[model samples]
Target: MNYNQPTDVLLIDDDVVNNFIAETLIKRASKHTNITVCLNGRDAIEKLLSIKQESGKLPEFIFLDLAMPVMDGWKFLDEYHRLNIGDGSNSEIIILSSSVFRRDIDRALKHSVVKEYISKPLNIELIRKVLKIDHHTN
Candidate 1:
């Protein structure tokens, strides 16, 4: 994936400060200026449905946080799969969370839609890796 190209991204997290940092880093790293932030999984689901209804499209990437008050990441993933949200799109869900437990990592990676698991305090390098940005090109 080319970082220079502008793409839509969905970020689901309840942390305001982390969200701000993530949005800034995402914009700087992948040039994904179009990012929608949802405080919880439920909100993310609503946003995804809304976007699909409005444009018949979905974001290319989804940054999911494991823990939240309203509908956790696991529940969202279940709903996403149950609803076939990625049937016609290349929407990859990346588990972006602070949890570093081995079980958490294993469980997340086992999920079909989850492309990769990334720790919190996301930086430019992780963003590039998640977006598959060619390192040499940049």
Candidate 2:
């Protein structure tokens, strides 16, 4: 796949394997894309704050996990909103979770910051769809 535009993507997951898989999938989707990994929501918030302070910018995409140590995705969203970090419009927070519960998905989607919700094991097709790239054309 090819992405004409460069994208900064953040993967916030407690699982190392999940992070690796997401990173690989993102790379496969577009070589020009940059991927950042955060093991927990706390670290991800810290990283985002630092980036905003240093560069006055946020990642274009954020792959968030609902269940994580230190701070969960819901808590992170609360903190992120409280801190007034990022413009919210620029960054797309996609909830990447293993939760099969409809309630969980509905809650996540109901959040203003959350753009979409996807199940675990982020794949090439899912990445492409998220990026709004036509697989056939790419």
Question: lDDT by residue for model 2 over 1-138, one digit each (tens)?
Answer: 236767889989999988888888888877788899998999999999999989887988899999999999999988988998866448899999999899999999888889999998789999999977676765
Tens digits of lDDT, candidate 1, 13-120? 999999999999887776555899999999998889888889978998999999999899999999888887777888899999999999999999998889999988
Least accurate 10 contiguous residues by lDDT in model 1: 25-34
Q: What is the lDDT of candidate 1?
A: 0.88
Q: Cα RMSD (Å) per model?
A: 1.6, 1.8
- Model 1 CA lDDT for position 32: 51
What would the TM-scores of all predictions be?
A: 0.92, 0.93
Candidate models: Cα lDDT each: 0.88, 0.88
CA deviation > 4 Å runs, candidate 2: none
lDDT of 2 at 60: 88
